[model samples]
Structures are given as structure tokens and as C-alpha cells.
Target: MTPEELTRPWPPPTPKPAERGAPPTPVPSAVPRRRLLRWAAVGAILVLLVWSVQGTGVSVGALIDGREGGLHLVRGFLHPDLSAAFLADVGSAVLQTVQISLTGLLLAAPLGLAGALLIAGNVGAPGWLRGSARAGAAFLRGVPDLLWALLFVATIGPGPAAGALAIAVHGAGLLAKLGAEQLEAIDPAPVEAVRLTGTGRAATAVLAIIPQARAGLASLLLYQWECNLRTSTVIGFVGAGGIGQELAISLRLFRYDELSTLILAVLAMILLVDQLSRVIRRRMGAAT
Candidate 1:
């Protein structure tokens, strides 16, 4: 290279295709396409939201008009019925709700564990078995607890038994699905190490997989129990028997004060269950 050319610039710019007498490269449209796609997605989401609002009949004016009635209800809730007779009934209903939730969870735990074992990938279950288990769990979960309660109510007559059975079935499905995911997500090293010992499948799973997944499984079960408790109260509204039945009665009679008391009782029960679950989970974690 000439010294003059080297002194002109340390690095010279390449000539453009147009200057080289070649057809100018077409500017890529990718950026514009991407921008269009993003705008399209935003528009689609906005359309969906508007459609949902219209279909659901959401109205700011209706909410404003109901302010007085809402205040009346709030006042009733503030001054909840605390009469001795009513309190006694509330206590009984609360006990029944607790019993129903306990019964449901007890019945669900074993069934859920079995289903979890079948569906869990690390367990080496056959594909067909896993698929079948998944299908069964889906069926159980697809039917709402309220519908299950109605079915049981029709078959066994309305009572806490129906509610318990409903909760059991639904809780089993929930636990099975969650437990399977938990099992799948556990540390694979322990499982692999156990298998290397030439242990049988069941032995390896019990020793390695179960131990690793125990805390998660326990947490899932406890959470399901809390869910069952809520479901128990709801099922009672269908005459399946629990605090929900009392709630239904109060609503039918327009006894807002009693309804408020029942609501408070439900809230207290939920808070108690939540706290108990947290403590149990903490202890389990510590023990592990």
C-alpha cells in the first residue's frame, strides 16, 4: 500500500454496493414486521378485554347506584348477630365444617399418593399407567366440588357426609396433580444413586424419591386440606350440610346480621387453618 493511502485513514470504509455498480441491497423488512406483530398482539388483547367486559355486563353506573345497599350490607356485617342461641348453632356448624374437611383430606391422601406415584415421571411408571392416572385426575378435577356434593346429596341424602365425599374426590385430584409435579421436580441425583445400588424400583422410590419429595407432598396435602375446608362450607349451601347450610338459610330469610356472623365464622376458620398449616410446614421443614 502507498504511504499516502495509509496516511489518509487508518481503516478505509468499504465502498457501498451502489458505488460498486451492483444493485443496492434491499433493506430488510424484519424490524417493521416485528413492530406490526407487537401492535397486533396488543390490539388483540385489548379486543378480548372489551369483549369480556361487554359479555359480563360490567357497568360503572350500576356499581354507583348500588352504593346505598352495599353500605347497608356493610353495616349489617359490622353488627353481626352474637346471640347465645345463634352462637351455639354457629359453633355446631363450624365443628361440622371442620369434621367434613378432615374426613375429606384423610380419605384423599392415600388415593392422591397412589395417583401421584403413577403419574410421576421419576417413578418409572409405564406411559399407559401415567396417562390413565392423569386422565382420572383430570376427570376428578373437572367436576366441581359443588357438583360432587349435589350428586352425593342425591344418593346419600343431604348431610355432611355428602360434603365430605365431594371434598375428598376433588382434593384427591388436586393433590395427585400437584404431588406428581413435585415428585418430578425433586433432585434426580439421589434417585440415580439409589438405582445404582441395584435396588428394586419400589425400594429405590421409597428410599430416595419419597424422602426428597416428602416435605413438598406434606405441604401440598395441607394446602389441599385448607381448600377442602373452603369447599365444605360452599357445598353446604346445596343442602350437603355445614356452615354453608346456615349461610344459605340466612340469605333466604334476609337475615344479613346472621349471615355476617356466619361469614365471620368462616373467616376465623380459614385463618386458623392457614396458621396451622404454616406452623406444620415450618416444623416439617426443620425436621427435614
Candidate 2:
């Protein structure tokens, strides 16, 4: 070997293809100040929540006390009096409650649909008209069912009519909100297609939107029906007719036996309605 070749320095190895034109990847840093602040805030909130709950006397002891009281009360309800007059009165009261809920729900459906249509952007009427409808629905919804029942009781005198009207008002508002949501979520393409066929807005809604929204609408209606049943029981508090008045009277008299009977009856009614609603909902799902 020549002395010049022996003196030459060795060359460094070539870089990989991936590393040739690539920029240096930045290294990940530690958690930022914002993240630390967030964790601190969360810890502070948890501390405040625990303190507030304890300060307000909302403790495990309160729950235990409530459970004990309920158990004691339930003991008296174990035996029920089966007098003929009492049974008849209960039957009549239950029938009255059913009538109130059904009548109210029926009256509410059309009004709620109209309100929903007016509030929905795709099928709303004139701007001011739509605004009025939405305002009416909001007003009705904001008022509690009990308040409406009391108001109707004052106006119409204590009876089933008052109770029915109260349920109608609240039910209409709730149904309107749900129905409007359903209407808004409907397929707009169908609506446009119907319009292209020279159909009017009302006609387009009837043909296009209603068909698609019918399932949700029906479900909402059944849900309202279930709710109204529960509401009807309480409307009797204002003397607007139902089993609730009798239950209240029995409680006032400390007739725990009779009260138990009423409670059981109400429980049965609720379970029945729930089962019926479930069946109908399933059928609706199948149809769709």
C-alpha cells in the first residue's frame, strides 16, 4: 500500500432514507401551566361540593332516617279494608282519572302539532306567527302542572273538567317541544322534493315531514299519556277530581290501611300504562 492511501481518513456512514430530508421531531414537554390549573380547579370544586353537601345536612344519616320513616309508614299499609262502599269509591275514582288523562291527551295532540309546525324552520308559517306560537308553547311549558290545575280549579270549580284542562296545557307544551325537535330533524330533501312537485308548504309538511316524523310523534304522544296519568292523580289535590283527594283524606285521617290500598292501585295503574306504552313503542319501531 502507498503511504498516501494509508494516510487517508475513513468517511462517515450515510443517513437512512427516512432521515435524509426530514426535519427534527420536537420532543414532548411536561404538562403545561393550563393543565395544572385545570387539575387544581377540579380539586377545589370537589372540596367545595363535599363541604356544601355536609353543610346543608344532606348526609347519609338523613337517608337512613327517611328510610326508617318510610318503613314504619309502610307497616300500617299492609292490611286494607275491603268494604263495598270503599271499593266502589276507588273504582269510580280510578275511572275518572283515566277519563281526565285520555281527554286531555286527545285535545293536546292537534294543538301541539300545530305549535311544533309553527316553530319548526322548514315548515313554519309567517315569522311573527311562528314567534307567537313558540312564545305560547314556552309560556305553557314554564308553568308547572300543579299550578295549571289550581288555576283551572279556581276558574271551572272543582271537577274533572279542570283537571283535564290543566293536563292539556302542560301536555301541549311538552309535546310541542318534542315534536318540533322531531320536525327539525326530518329529511329536508323530501320536503324540497315535494315542493318541486308544486305542492304548497302545508301540503309538503303533511306529505313529507309528517310521514318521516310520525314515529317520533307517536312515541311522544304515548309518553305524554303516561305522564298525564301521573299528573291526573295529583290534580285531585285542588279538588279537581281523582283518587288523590281520597288518598289525601285518608292520610289526613290517619287511615293508613285505606291509603295503602290507594297506593297499590296507583302502582298497578302505572305498571299497566308502562307496559302498554312499551308494547305500542315496539310496534311503532317495527312499523318504521
Candidate 3:
């Protein structure tokens, strides 16, 4: 606090330069390359989509031009051949189709459930066993349903029997795969509790696992039913015996009226099935 210290340029004053005006604000450099890349990527995707549509002959303009033809066709279907004779044939064909679907679904359900259990690792199998089951299911799924029907036809001769068997085989594999996955994703707590209760494997699976997975099981069955219905149509094409056979014959004979009627009938059947399935599923979900 001496007077001299205070007065002696504060002992040793530091020279400070005045603040140079604020350093120039940063200006981002333009990235032409990045912008170009973004635009190029968008352009490339557009080009690819356009080329795909063009290659497939999917011309929107042409579709628009043919809209009237489509309308006429639809009108023809609305006034389908409802003659008594044709009606009899339609009734018979429809009965065959339904029979095939129901029978196939029945056959597929248990088999599919078993396959799913094995493949989805719900069953206490070794990894290799599970893998093999899964692989087999995948193989079945990979083959076209028509191919399966053809194989059955070639081997066993053409008929509803061939159709049913083909559908059954494929349906089993599909349902099994789905069921197995549903089993895999279930609440393990119940399964563990079942085990802890000294329950056998079969009891544990049936009571603890199956109940929990019932919704998925039902859904899979219903889905397979839908698929089987479509499949039955295809089998008819190969003489596996269904409305499809009649359809093929009608087409070959240029029986446009009959063909239209048949198509309408098939469409009605599909729509009815779809509605019924939806209702059933809704009821199930609600009950659960």
C-alpha cells in the first residue's frame, strides 16, 4: 500500500493492444460436390423406378386408355351367366373348392404347429434339430404352391386329392414356421413356471405355451385358409380338379360369359372368406 508502488506505472504495466474489431464472422464454404451428390442420388432413384416401370410395360397412359375396357369387363361380371345349368356347374365347383380349403386347413394345422414348435425352438430340441426343421419349412415355403400341386398331380394323378395334398404339405410347413415364431416370442415366465411345477414337457407345452400362443395359432390357421383357397384355384389350372379347371376350359373355349361368371363366383368366395376371417379374428382378440 505504499504511495510509490501505486504511482510507479502500477509497478510493471502490461501493454494491451485495443481489441481488433471482432474476428471476421465465419462464412461456410459452399459444397457443390455434396449438393451434386444429393441431387444425383435422387435422380438415380427416379431413373431406376422409371426404367423398372417401363421395362415391365406398366404404362399409366395405356392403363388410362383401357379403363373403358376394364369397366365393360366389370359390367359383364355384374351380369354373370346365372342360368340354371351354369348355376349347377358353379355350385359343384364351389363345393369342391371349399372342401379342398377346409380339408387342407385341417390337415395343416397340427403338422404346422409341430413344425413351428421344432423350428421356432419352442421345443427343447438341439440347435441342429431346430435348424433342420426350419430349413425344411423354408424349402416348402420357397417352392411355388402351383409347383407343389403339379408334383402331386404328376405323382398321384390329377384330382381334388392331389390339390388337397399339395395344399396340406405347403400349409403345414407355413403354419409350423409361423407357430414356432409365435412360440419363441411368448412370455417365458409361464413356461418356466410350468416347468417348475413338475409338469411334463407335453403338459407344459399344451397348458402354458399353447394357451398363450392360441391367438397366433388361430391367426396362422385363418391365414393358411385364405392361402389354400387361392391355391385351390391354381390347382384347377393343372387338372388337380377345382373351379380353376373349369375356368381354364372356359378360357380355352372362348366362353367369356361363363369365364366371367366363374371369376365372379371365385371373387365372391374370397371376399366372403375374408369377411368371416376378420370377424373371427376380431372376436378372438376381444375375448383375449
Candidate 4:
């Protein structure tokens, strides 16, 4: 109202409480070169992924179109044929499968252990012997299981015996390879101690080294058994005589219900072996 007040210049507006004592806005630093490259790579990957999905025609619509067949399978699973006849057939098949796997496992143990010891140079075997064993194990492992089964079938005819031999030969090589690795990783102190006492190589292994690696060897053996169990069914498809033979026959006849039953039986056997292996491994751990 006064002339002096009107002549005074207007003052700058006061900052709000929230803005008081705040630092000035800062400029963003340049991103690192590596970070930019990473982001670029990630974007490229995403583009490729999207293009692949589209190229493959993988979409919700395709899944929906396939649901009818899936539903039919689910329905058969829900009402699996559990009749006496079915059970009897499944039981016989299961027995044959188990027999083949068991026989193979039994055969693999001695062969695999011998092969492992032969390959692990600590046993004082001749260099030639070790090399020979290594080559033999590699050869067996290199050949596919189906080919082994076919080879045996040609000589022994299409039966459980052929299946057993096939799985045995294949499983032995795997077990030996894994077992030798375990042996190599064992502490050398015990082996050295036995050697200092004038023990023979075989005696030292039996007394000291073998005990240390026993649990691992057992795990390898049980793992091979599990593999052989699964392989037994596959070999049966080639007329080796097991549930897979029945499965092939059922599939050929389009007997969905019977197929479901066979699948359930196989699943049961797998679970049983799984539980058994777990129990055995636990016992081995406790013993060690």
C-alpha cells in the first residue's frame, strides 16, 4: 500500500520444505561399454527366440488342437485295465524285466570292478594290460545298447538272455569308467601306508583303497542297475522278451487301455527300484 513497498522489487519465491537442502540435479554418467554390449546381446537373443517360436509354429492354438489326444490318454490312465488277466501278464513281464536287469547287474559288478582296477594304474598291472582294458571298456561303451542287443540276439536268439547280455556289456563299461574315476579321486595316504608295510598291490587295494571307494563304487553300480532296468524294457521291443514286447504289440493293435496298464506297471517298477537304490545308498553311507 505504501509508495516505498510498491517501489520495492518483488522477492524470489521461497523453496518448499521438501525441496530445501536438496542437491542440484546431476547429469547421468555414461554407461560402461561392457554393459551396453551385454544389453545388445540380450536383445539379439530375445529377437532370435521370438523368431524361433514363430518359425516352429509353437503357440497356444497348436497346444489346444493337441489337447484331444492328451485327454484321451489321460482318460485311459484314469481307468487302466487292472483285471486278473492283465495283472498276470504284467506280473510275468515285470518278472522277466527284473530278471534281465538283475542278471546284467550281477555280471557288470565283477567285470566293472576288474576293469576299473585294471584302468586305475595304482594296481601295478603291466602297462599293456591297463591299455588293453581301457580300450576294451571304451569299445563296449562306444557301441550303442540297441546294437549290442541286436548283436546278442543274432547269436543267442530273441529272448531275455540276449537282453541281459546286452545290458551287461554296456553297463559294465559305464560302471568301469565311473568307478575308475572314483578310485582316482581317493586319498593316497592309506594306499601309501599299506605299501610301506610291504603289502602287495592287490592286497593293499583290498585292505585300504577298496574300503575308501566302496560306497562310491556301490553308487555307480546302483546307478548302472537303474539304467539297465530302463534299457531292459527298450530291448524287449526288439524281441528280447519283456513288457516292452507287450507294449509294442498293444500299440500295434491300438489297445489304449492295455497300453495304459503296461505303462503303469513300468512306472511302478521304476519307483520300486528308485526306492530300493535310495535305501541301499543310505545304508552304504551309514556304514562308511
- Candidate 4 lDDT, tens digit per residue, 180-211? 88887889988898999999888987988788
Q: TM-score per candidate, in order?
A: 0.91, 0.81, 0.79, 0.76
Alpha-carbon lDDT, every model:
0.92, 0.89, 0.85, 0.88
Candidate 2 residue spans exceeding 4 A from truth: 1-32, 39-72
What is the TM-score (0 to 1) of candidate 2?
0.81
| Candidate 1 residue lDDT tens string, 1-288 | 888887897578889878899897688779889999999999999999999999998899989999998888888888999999999999999999999999999999999999999999899988998899999998998899999999999999999999999999988898889999999999999999989989887897799999899889988989998998889989999998999999999989878899999999999999999999999999998999
Which parts of model 3 are misplaced by more than 4 Å?
1-40, 60-79, 197-203
Instruction: Point out the worst 10-residue segment of candidate 1 by lDDT.
Output: 4-13
**After TM-score superposition, what is the CA distance of residue 202 in candidate 1 from its true location, in Å?**
1.6
lDDT of 3 at 79: 72
Model 2 per-residue lDDT tens digits across residues 114-198: 8999998889589998899889999998999999999999998988999999999998988888899999998899899888999
In candidate 1, list every pair of residues with a backbone clash.
Answer: none
The superposed Cα distance between candidate 3 and the true structure at residue 274, in angstroms, equals 2.4
> So what's the TM-score on candidate 1?
0.91
Number of colliding residue pairs in each model: 0, 0, 2, 0
- Measured with C-alpha atoms, the lDDT of residue 141 in candidate 2 is 85
